[model samples]
Target: MPVTPGGKASDGTRADAGALAGVEECEEAPDVSLEALGSVATTTDASPGTVVPGSPAGTPAGPVSGTSPDREAAGTGSGRDTPVERLEDPGNSATERGTGRPGVAEKTLEQALPSVLADGPPKVLAELARAPQRSRAVRRDGLRRMGIATGLVALLAVVFCAVQVLRPLPGPALVMTGAPSYTIAGAPLTPAWPGEGEAAVEVEGVGSLGAYGDQKPIPTGSMAKVMTAYVVLQDHPLKNGDDGPVIAVDAQTAKESTAPGESTAVVAEGQRFTERQMLQLMLIPSGNNIARLLSRWDAGSDAAFLGRMSGAARQLGMNDTTYTDPSGLDAGTRSTAVDQIRLARAAMQDPTFSAVVAMPRVTIAGVGQIDNNNTDLVDPGVIGIKTGSTSAAGGNLMWAAQQTVGGSKQLILGVVMAQHSAGASDYGLAKALAVSQKLINQVRKALTCTTVVHRGEVVGYLDDGVGGRAPVVAGADLTVIGWPGQSTQLTLSAPVTGLPHRAKAGTTVGTIALRTGQAAGTEVPVVLQHDMTTPGLSQRIARLR
Candidate 1:
């Protein structure tokens, strides 16, 4: 144990005092122990029977040569034949320490940690550094997905913008300003009244002239057949010359034809007749039985046909009219004079109905040649319309006449209802004809065609924004049939300031609407009287004030 100057042992061995001092200094370390260090430092002198500190009780010390008895027993001193030693000792060099035991310098606190947590601060710092990298990777993935969504949204927006840019534009909207009104200069012509009846006259395009007496519903003897013919023609349509669908005359129709006091057309059972021929027999001869027969053939029943007749009356604006039966033989069938005129106007619109009513006589296969009972058909300018007469209805006539008024053929539709003669011998037919003739003469004398706007006449002006105005003139002679000395209203429609910079002379600029009385007005196209040219900029600027 004697120390030399170099701190060696008395036997000239190195004392290892410095290494033991180094091990003592390491005793201040949290994981190193003095007991564990003493065990390693005393290992050089320790006998095989000596126990080491901090080792398990009875754990024998190894040989000082750092070899074990097992190595001696094996009679070999190879490098693998070494004994285990404590790790807290710094006295032993790493070369002296056996490979079976980890040296204190080699086994650090970090290396002594459990295998699961063997990596210490540097490993944690490395993992922390890698944490940011992992976070960045996640963020990058999220950003990549967000960028793809943004790209898709941007693509959709681009497509929508392209569609909108390529879509067509609509035209400018035009606004309607006003319509025209009128005032008649003199007293309007009035029609003569038949006895105990109402009368109304309606010109084709000129509305109703006037109505006399109360328009009360009155019985129509045979005139209800006109509606029967109208409904049948509407359901089974007949062209001007086309013979329509055929209908067989059944036994019920033949029996009804022969009933007393009923107008008959001599139809036999099993007789087949075209719809046109049936209409001729019904309307021209005022056949009541044929009207019923037509009703049955068209609608399969008289009650259903009567429903259609009533519905047709309502549609024609005949508010005061009612039909209880298809034939006027039923006294319950009633209509007013004004309502009858409405019906006549609608019926005459059909060319076949008009032609059939105009016939003075018609010949049928079953019945001999039957003359039209409407005596008014023979009168000049008087067209055939249905006529009705009975004790309950007196006399009813729905008449249409084409009379020359102001050099234009004007259609005059009039209705006279409930006319009666003093005696039964003189029926009301003569009275109705006299009254109709008087009204026709009066209307013809009252109306005259007047030129409201002549061709090339200026009706309006188009402003050029510089004090210059271009005249808008009528393109054609605008004439309308109106009452004499009546005031005509002229309404002009044109763009006030939006005229093109350069316009041709014949370019249509507006319309001149001429109205006389309460009728629908006639329109004439208004054109530029002369070419319109834009004013110079200097002129426009000068007029800016």
Candidate 2:
């Protein structure tokens, strides 16, 4: 009996026909099994001559036909080989069946590559571990260099700050230079007279109150003629008895002074007189020709004399004053009240200047001289200053007086310039006198020596020494104010009364004024005005009774 390739009986062979034969054939098929077909397969081949278990082939080299389980499986099934499972025991353990080779399952990329890379160390750490080591000495040197650089930077910052703090920028330095603050005791030192004019109060040491108006510039009229006289007296001294000095009136002076529509002393042409008489005519009569004659004599011409006037004014600190002509007739001659007061203060200091200006009359030596017509200065206490008039400058006047208080004599100067009205010249003069008198009284009341003395044998000897039952006169007519108190110091602003200059009878002799205190305060007249000469004893005693 033959078996088919599919492990079935052959076509001509019967199942019973080959029962014994088929059994032999089946036993032989195990030796020719498909397990022997694959190359390099580890399974053992069971072919011819192989042994079988429980078979008549003697060694049992081959499986028995129909009795061996493997032979039965190969014979009954189709020819394809099936997988083999080894049996360890009757009830086999499945774990014992695996081969020594790992049964590795198939892996996706997601699980394999990522797991490998993640488990490895980073490349940078690996490289650093292989780098060279720095020595301890090199590390110390680097730290020291860093510390030095930091300290140098900090030192530079401190040096810059010190330089900025110590240095000073250049500019102007701080300093101060001026007069100490002082107050004049009186009513706010008003323009003593009205409407911005110049006044010349007679003063000693400084000269007539010419500097008063010098503060402001304005045209001066007849008053400038007085300045012309002032300049002449600066050079020549006029004695009271020396009436023979020759004063030739030049032709030019005669023509210019007596020109049509000009103010004149009416000196005849070519007339000659003493210097003393010319000064008297110039001042007492307000003579224009006399001013011209004297100017020419002193400085060679009126124009030259005016030059000296300017120089004198500048020397006296009259910065605002200017003189275009000798007589103030030319509206160009001008000054302020402040400058005029200065000039007057200067004039009162000079005995000769005071005498010439105060005289009411003079006797000419050679030909013609005139009596003074300035009635304003006739009063003994009313010292002659100067007067001026013009169409533009108007009427102006300045005067001064002296009075005694507490046995001390003082002088008060006043001025009125540029009173612009017709027939107002005397009005300014009267106003000046009235204001000055008031000032004198205010100062006297404030003085420390305001002692009241009744009419008696002698209250005290006057500077003039005209003694008798000296009439008790009010220092200044206390019209504006009744009285002033103590704590006010009255000093003689100028000098003692009866100062040897030609003065009027019953003229104000001195000005009594209070001292300026810590703050600006008031000043008034303290002593009484008196005549230069006193009356007889009978008249004084009558007044006393």
Candidate 3:
């Protein structure tokens, strides 16, 4: 065999018509020694197999003419047909490897490649070059599969993104809240309850304040007269300043008017009086006979009229009330301060009833004038309501007063019952008026003015159908009367047609109703604070992993 030092044949020619293209080749004629070819395969850079490129994937697959019978390897992974010849090493002898086989360590491509080619047939040279090309083709197929897999992964990512972008989202978080004060707080002082009786108070549009001790049913006395008047007005409704239908005084009522020890308005049998005048006589002077006379005139008899009063009580929401007679003179007619307050609230809403009760005096034909028994009506803030007194029921008064709060007249209704004195008959009514007047004055003073909510404050937010939101703000300051330490609650009205999405700055969405549990609430307009546009991914929907 003759081989070139440059990894090519000595002839500088291929072994046959077919040969390796780029790699150095060797041509052999017969049996050859590998010693001359050992140094030919090594370079100064090739000190070990680490720097060596792998041999042309070992020998070609089938048998060849040049290989001897002893040359085949036994199950060796290298794929070489023959046992490798050893390269010279300074530390070991040539046959140091067991079985005298070649060792891969310290071997370089420059040292090993030429010897195999030099002693082999022309097909081995062609196979050396062809084996590498075959390996390169396998790698090219693997790279093509990897590229297609990469493209599929990229396509899946794109599909996931498109689905997320088109998906629908729930509306934004919309809630209304007021600015809570951390330090600006104080509880309202309790109402001054009467020393010895049942009492309660209620502001118009506000709920009941509270009922004090022994609120169970008690005699209503002349307070029953108020209910009589309420029933009378209900049957024969009258507008203010109008004299209603006239009624002739009956013989029985005229006779009772002259009774020595009974309450009555002066009257003559067969004499006619208008309905308004009759009620004035019954309510203002507390004419007991007039009360009975009106009851008989409305219903066929007194018993039937009592049934109407009881029915009226139920209709007015007076659950703890009972009526046994047309007049409160019967102790069997029982009521609670809570029940009377309910009736008083409904009665005051009528103009004819309220006006008649507030009158100081009314002129008549025979009797020059009759003064109202409810003298407290003359007080500045005090208005028309009724008073009742009896030996059994003590003194009870149902009263209404007015005060200017936030430039609007606020009506207050109250009831004080069972004010009694063992010493004198007059003490009961006097004590009731005195106690109620004091409570009214205290309430008038305690009605403090404050700004509950400020304009442009973020009381809540309006949500879009997507995940976007805009601030729902108060459009104007809410300056109104409210008690100290009162907590305010807010509620939203349905948003205007297009909200959060099409909202503009200062556009009214709805009104926020503010309640303090103290008095009538004030309503403030809710508006958007800033203009809105499109929402982002995070705002429109939950974040995608």
Candidate 4:
């Protein structure tokens, strides 16, 4: 066999060499060895009786014209039958030969020239070339479906957002309407002792203990005089009490201050007493007459003092208090328990007010000092405050007390107004005292004890129950009821407005006035329980020592 290097056929005959005469023999009788020719053409020529091994062993064979390159070329001519050869060669099977069997033909104009001129183009051949472009069309349909799906998803998202935006929120967190602190210990503290009304002790930045009967307007008895004294003291101080400035009792005061079944300092018409003497009579004795005198000295008339009282009430936001006279003798002074608590907190801020209210007794230079009649404050823990009594207004009083809690000082104010009247025995002073005791007990129970630090050391406890029992802090002066459970709203007012930092612990800070509705509320002493001053480096170092 002759072989060509580099996969070429060289000058070899094709498989059809024996089937046809040679080219030179085409013009004459050809002389060729079929066997030699068949060998070169890659075919077999066997006798009728011979057998090929891979074929049926005993089968007689014809001239074998196995698949050859020429046969494939021949099928392209004559527009004749082209055997639909199974595109795969089963015997050689793709995996056995590294060069796999031919796939579906992809016809091009240049390579398919002969077929194009014959029966146009085979339908299968034309379609085979178009398969790739048709695949793109299928992918386009999928993209269209995905686009529609995305649009539906976006629409649903928008609808959900709209529904959420249109919905409403929950309602306000309210437990009860109106004030709830009045029903303390099964008694009312409004318009009288244990009278029904709202009240609270609000230490700024700390929580409030009680919130009851803050809206009612009821008589506050002699407690109204607290406002009168507060206003007078705010505007005027004793002109050197030892010198004893003559305060002539005016006729208008004697007439206006007189109330049926109301106590007076027994101030006679034109009777003169020092301002200091008047204050003792007014606060210690709870004298309606002396209140009138102080009012006349400061505002020139009880009506003027009453007007100032109302104005002050408005400034302090005592919306429920009303005042007709400064003495609280029941020409119609009124307030709620809560308003009185406000007034008490405001009055307790003044140093002088605290001193005056806390003194057990005092003697005037010109006139002999009267007894401090408020025995309720004589209790060791009690701090004496002001008291008021009148038949119409009932017995009313404001007092403050202190106790240790969580290593800190906690102050409490108790107020009583419109208490049940005792039948003419010392003007219900005894009943007022009883009411004060009851109020004190309620306050002590309401206080939640906790500990707090002052100046980096554990000082005391705060009763406000705001958590951590931190240091007790009172920003303004606070007033308390001299009597217990007085029903009236309290409003706080300061003469100079806001307080200063670095106020000494125990320093008077502001006023707590107790009153009922739009009336001048009574004032009480309020003091600082903790130091608010920031220390300098030197001061801090010294403190360490």
**TM-score of every candidate:** 0.62, 0.44, 0.69, 0.47
Model 1 per-residue lDDT tens digits across residues 440-511: 777767766766668887666767655666777788987777664455667776656544656888888777
Top TM-score hit: 3
> Which of 3 and 4 is the better model by TM-score?
3
Cα RMSD, model 1: 19.6
Give candidate 4 regions above 4 Å deviation.
1-112, 115-215, 237-261, 266-277, 441-545
Better of 2 and 3 by TM-score: 3
TM-score of 4: 0.47
Candidate 2: where is the Cα deviation over 4 Å? 1-215, 238-244, 365-373, 422-545
Give the Cα error of residue 521 in candidate 1, in Å.
4.4
What does candidate 2 score on TM? 0.44
Q: Model 4: how far is 247 from its true place, Å?
A: 5.2
Comparison by lDDT, 2 against 3, better one: 3
71: Cα error in model 2, Å? 99
lDDT of 4 by residue, 109-228 (tens): 212222221221232234333555566889999999999999999999778655544433221111111232221132432222355433344322123445544457877877786787
Query: How displaced is residue 345 in candidate 2, in Å?
Result: 1.7
Sorting all predicted structures by TM-score, with the top scorer first, yields 3, 1, 4, 2
Number of the predicted model whose lDDT against the real structure is largest: 3
lDDT per residue as tens, model 3, 85-135? 334453544343334655533442334454444444453345444555666
lDDT of 2 by residue, 434-464 (tens): 5445444443344333332222212122332
